[model samples]
Target chain A: MAEAEGEMSSLLEEAAARRAAPGRALVRDAGLIVGAALDMAARFRRDGRLLAFGAGASAADAGHLAVEFTHPVIVGKRALPAISLANDASAVSGIAVSRGYGAVFSTQLRMLGRPEDIAVGFAVEDRCGDVLGAFAAARQLGMLTIALVDGALMDRTLVDGTLVDHVLDARSGDPRIAGEAHMTTYHLLWELVHVFLDDPAPLDGPGTAASGCAADATCVTCADTAVPVHVTELRPGGLALVDTGGGTEEVSVALIEARVGDTVLVHAGEAIAVLGGDAP
Target chain B: MTGALYPFAAAGGDTTREELVMSTAAKAAESVELRLRVLERLGPSLAACARAMATAFRAGGTLLAFGNGGSSTDAQSVAQLFLTPGRGGRRLPAISLTGDSALLTALANDVHFDVVFARQLTALGRRGDIALALSTSGGSANVLRGLEAARRAGLVTVGFAGSGGGRMAAERLADHLFVVPSSSVHRIQEAQATLCHVLWELVHQALAGAEAGGVQAGGEEASDGGLGAGGVGADGVGAGGA
Candidate 1:
């Protein structure tokens, strides 16, 4: 019994360790994730809805992502329009039967996707043909495309600004670990998108224009913008001292009711909303 | 070129990009911490549950999984994981009650949404089978109903819940309950996924132990070490030394 218990403990530890590396890898792509949220917010500002799809377990992820956006779990957060292409089994089966299985997501994308919408695809390991196809279709429709894929499967072509605007890799070969990392990735995406949307900053800033993806200059959109600041002290005159990653900055909090010890989304010296707080 | 690509660098004084990086890092750290905590807390219970599950599977029992919303999708993933696991893993008999959209909608529209899973359990569940339900809140009406039905039918009930197990913990609705001690729904679901995966691995391990010990059907005299002494045979067919 002692030996058995030891083995079980070791197994549990191994499982926990295996899931950690992929999650850590996501921290390296914070800039990319934040950028994606900015562009997703831009698309939503244009009355665009999010269309998410994937295969097998990833299909479930697609549903989870869609629900997170369409139904805000946190009170006071606005519900954004979103839909999961994998939710309707009847439609998926019909598309697979009529137009090969690889056409499932692509077919749905072509039918429902719009120029202003956002398309997020989930692909575990190398089983990403349908997701790749959907990205291709999304590109043709001028949609903002993002992909969450396994690190082993990400290659030059997928990240070369051709297929996906944002390619976040969950750096793990194990599909389960990759799925967990993907969950965290999308949660960040959901949270940061709200942060950007709440901010009144112009999406096409000087940095955006320099990236060669200005709204009027070109149709291309880049994902690398904005960050949240930690509020250290709330001043009396609608101002707060915020930790801006490097140093403290006194920013106007007139737009938001921010408290000390809260993370606030800042844009051009103004605090928009308190990050990860209850709606008050 | 560097400033252009990195908006934070181009924004002059705003160095909050580092904070953005830190935020992601913080969430990742939180996730790892929660997972480790769950493993440390539930390791023994997980092992015992896996043993029971292996015994039920050996006796030709299928796994019936159900949940709501994201948990509903997770239920489908659980079924899929068992039915088609990773390389070198054996295919197990499992079904997600949330797979059939038409049936689920019909049940919800015709009857109350609370009875969708319970009605399915009545039709598909049997004694000695396993019922796995996932709920972030642990107070979902339909999930409680499903557990009640599973208990009535003699199926081994397992529940994955969060936020102090909600009412499921209070009422003891599950034979083996794993509650992720968090109020964040996203974190709870992530930890639940890890728990499910670990349980799957342990079940495989238990099954392997059974195989190595030559514990086959119709051999009441055979003793496959202490692994077969879990006393999970409510049906009386697969009990050890029956």
Candidate 2:
């Protein structure tokens, strides 16, 4: 087992070494293209919508990227223009069966994608009919295109004259790490796109992060959210109360407390908790 | 030993309480492991399929789910999860192919069990609709038939199956086949419940633009509580606390 572990470590080192190469050349090139993508995203903010597509690992990446744009973590941030192509199963299957799997995303791009919209194509393997067709259709529609291709399969011609404005070969490491790396690449890109949207001063400041809301947490009742009521009657599950907000509207069987004038979050049909108290 | 152990006696030895408990635990762990591995490996594909379902519903398309036995129950549970609101937002248009006894019995007895799901798909499915089928073995004839019919009807097919994906994994009928590897029915069913719950939650997460699916406002969002007069009567399809 020790010998096996030693051999595995050596192989990982070699793969890592290969990735960190290009003598600053590739870094400069990637920076330029990433800059271009940021600009295109700014253009999308103006008049275009960005549509992302992929299958398998690619699909997850597309969804993750779309979520970042659609659901910005920043509290007051408005959503940017974006949609994930992989999210529509009907379109994919319809195109796959009728026109072939290759035309699945391509058909949708042709129909719904406007000239101002951008198409971001992610391909895990070299020969993907769906990816190719989507790229072609997006180009024909005169929309900006970006290809996040994996490893050494970087055939520059795939993007040549077509509307593919940027190609970032994320030269991701070995088979196991490749998919995850692609995900990380896009996650980073999603954040960078946000940088293009917000002002520069806030960019220097710490970026906003997601709140850690668990699956089981209920909405905590506080004075700000719930309307106060006076307990008029008590029922089996909880309480009945008269609304303090206005004319004698009655609320029945909510929360554990039936004490008159006590506020509670009316959860479900029944009130489940007391205001400013730990949720039951 | 229980009566169920008699079948196993023919191939091996008598079943013991210790063995049954240990095996059940092992099977549960194995099933959970396999499910996590598949999700980790096929994250993008599954996420993509889920996203498509979300988009289809958002664009006025409906989601339909089906299966046999335990899978049938799972289908109903998932449909109910979506059709009802737990915390946030209103109910989306989702239907379980197994919910209506009249339709199921009619399709099962008149045509054949194999055509039960297929015929339903034929009648209801349209372009941009999503058809989700669940089977632990992934080899249910009725499920496969339904998948074929869904494909013919231009609906996206997603299958959740187990044990090396069986026929559904190989037939290419499922655009996405999430295979839970363990063979134990109990473990697979438990994990299937978890998987569907996650998908249902994701649908809500995507819809509400919330990070997690939390309990929000319940019924009384509107006069009819988001359900139309004739559509989805006051069983309060979208009413549930947490």
Candidate 3:
């Protein structure tokens, strides 16, 4: 009895340690997930849906992630279309038993995915054969491939273009930690994608160069109605007084060194970047 | 170069690569430390949960588990663990209310989602049955409703929730509540899994007689020794998977 008690304590601590190990992995690798989310959001704008797949315990993640996107438990958030390839366990097993386990998810993707859709697959072991098949199938369909993997093949993912474009690796040997890391990665993707959707013409807009600060945000030409501006006064730090076709306004000049009478690009009371010379 | 929330190197072009490497290393060390602390704190409560669950199971009660989202998976896992009991333990009768897609969809579509689990419990639950629910937030309306239904039906209600126990604690819904006092959802889920394993083992120990004997139930795919691995689990969509 005493021995059982001691072992239980030890087991709890061990499980906690295993579970806790993913936070570091999330912090280090979550940026790559964010970058992928940005791309996926662009795909979303094109009316693309998300298709997710995984095997074993990870199968549950596929369902959880799908419901999160489709139903959106949070109030006021719009639902995004998502489907879990593993939702129908009968079909999955039927395929596995009849055709092969590898064909289960791939067959689903071939039937459901489109060229503009996004395919996200996850795995816990060094390789989830079914997930690998799904990614390959999705890539062939011209879908964007995102993999949340924490297995031994993680190092090879960066080198393998055919396997995945955006790979967020938990870098853990434990499945529990990998599962936790995958959740964090997907949550970050959901959040960062929302950040992109919150804008009509975000950083990728025509007039915006995606400069470091908002002071350098170029909405002048992008906004479609800003008038041409001529620099009337030039101060240090790229600050400029410009005369819009309408009136004089002050704008920041971080992108360009504006001189008096120089044609400066200004947007909503800010100078985006300076034109090389005065407007014709 | 220092960081605000984390100890990170100053962002610079030349040192960025080296700094990122250092930052990951430092962050890993810190995370392991925090995980260990969280684990240490959960030991006692996990023990309590095991003792309680063992008593309930030994008394011939069934475990009816439920949850939402990722937590629903946890509830299913809990049921699977009890139903199989792996190697050393006698298989106990447990059902995950979330496992039935037909029932889940019907309840969700026909009436309302809040009553999905509660309605099922009303029909299926009996006195001396055990109800186990998993919710990271502890505030999931459905889980709360299910727990209330389980308790009213004479079932012993237990909950696995994240830090602060959310509304589960606020309303005292669970008879034996296991709270993973972590704000991070990942950590909380992981801790919850660990707690379940501990509690499951204890329940088995309580039930495993000399005739039952010890069986290896570690990591290896230890299928049935004498019981046979028939219908290993309810794989959500159907009866079993290949």
Poorest 10 consecutive residues by lDDT, candidate 1 chain A: A206-215
Worst 10 residues of 3 chain A by lDDT: A206-215
Q: Provide the DockQ value for model 2.
A: 0.02
Q: Pick the candidate with the highest TM-score.
A: 1
lDDT of each residue in B1-242, candidate 2, tens digit only: 21232233223443332333343334324433544554445554555566667666766677789987546645765665566533333576778897577887898788788998999999999977889999988899999999999989888788988778888988888876787766655446545554565565455444443222342422222233322111111111122211
Candidate ranking under lDDT, highest first, comes to: 1, 3, 2
lDDT for each of the candidates?
0.76, 0.56, 0.65
Residue B223 of model 3 has an lDDT of 51
**Per-residue accuracy of model 3 over B1-242 as CA lDDT, tens digit each:** 12222232223213232333344445444444544565577567657766666666666678899998778877776776677543444667888898688999999999999999999999999988889999988999999999999999999888888879999988999988878776756456655765676577556554442114453222222355423211211221121222
Candidate No. with top lDDT: 1
- Residue lDDT tens for model 2, A168-245: 665552322333334434544554454445432221121111011111333221112344444444532222544544
lDDT of 3 by residue, A123-204 (tens): 6654355676676677666677888777555436432443566777777766556665676566556645655565423334
Proportion of the native interface contacts kept in model 1: 0.36
Q: Which residue pairs in candidate 3 collide?
A: A238-A253
Q: What TM-score should be assigned to candidate 1?
A: 0.77
Off by over 4 Å in 2: A1-280, B1-28, B208-242
DockQ of each: 0.18, 0.02, 0.13
Give me candidate 2's TM-score against the actual structure.
0.39
